[model samples]
Target: MAFWTYMLRCVDGHYYVGHTDDLDARIAGHQSGLIGGYTQKRRPVKLVWWQEFPSRAEALAAERQIKGWSRAKKQALIAGDWESISRLARSRSCR
Candidate 1:
């Protein structure tokens, strides 16, 4: 089974990051508010992005990394703009 790192864009326009072994089930729970957390209150979230990893640890690590990103960086990622993502990272470091 592959582990997944996923991002949800909530109705409030905020993003939530998480890692799970059962991606579909997890997303379903979030959508139904059965998950009962950040996503639950932010209901009607859309699955904006997701990537599968070979291990849970890797997925968790990716989740943590994304959670720290700025909204712009996350948007760049969602748009699959790697160049913009890299530029944003460099700009951050130079600050």
Candidate 2:
């Protein structure tokens, strides 16, 4: 079974990162407010990015790593700007 690391652009303009075995169903739950917590109140989210992983552990790891990233980093990711993502990571580490 495939797992996924996904990012959602919330209606409030914030991003939410999560891992799921069922991308479609999970996204539907979030859209319908069936999934609680951060995304629940920030309903009406849009799937902006996602990556498939061979294992749930890898997907979860990606989700956790992304969750710790700054908004700029996340935006770079959503935009598929690998150069900017690398630059941002380097700059962040130098801080």
Candidate 3:
């Protein structure tokens, strides 16, 4: 089965990252406040980015990696700005 790693923009302007095999159902749960966690409290979340992978391991790895990224890095991924993403990575390592 395929799995997806996704990012959501919450109502409060924060980002949520997760991996799921059921994309639509998972997003629906988040929307309906049934997820009962960060996005549940934030409410009215919007999908900002996603990537599909052949294996659950790949999707989960991507999710975990993205979760630790800075907001700017997330935005760069959402915007497909590889240069900005690379730059952000360098800046973080330099600090």
Specify the highest-lDDT model's number: 2
- lDDT of all the models against the reference? 0.96, 0.97, 0.96
Candidate 3 residue runs with Cα over 4 Å from true position? none
- Taking the tens digit of each residue's C-alpha lDDT, what string does model 1 give over 38-68? 9999999999999999999999999999999
- Candidate 3 accuracy as TM-score: 0.97
Q: Residue by residue across 1-95, what tens digits does model 2's lDDT show?
A: 99999999999999999999999999999999999999999989999999999999999999999999999999999999999999999999998
What TM-score would you give candidate 1 relative to the actual structure? Answer: 0.98
Q: lDDT of candidate 2 vs native?
A: 0.97
- Give the poorly placed runs of model 2, Cα more than 4 Å off: none
Candidate 1's C-alpha lDDT? Answer: 0.96
Per-prediction TM-score to the true structure, in the order listed: 0.98, 0.98, 0.97
Ranking of all candidate structures by their TM-score, best first: 2, 1, 3
**Candidate with more favorable, higher TM-score: 2 or 3:** 2
Q: Quick one: how many clashes does candidate 1 have?
A: 0
Give lDDT tens digits, candidate 3, residues 1-95: 89999999999999999999999999999999999989989999999999999999999999999999999999999999999999999999999
lDDT of 2 at 5: 99
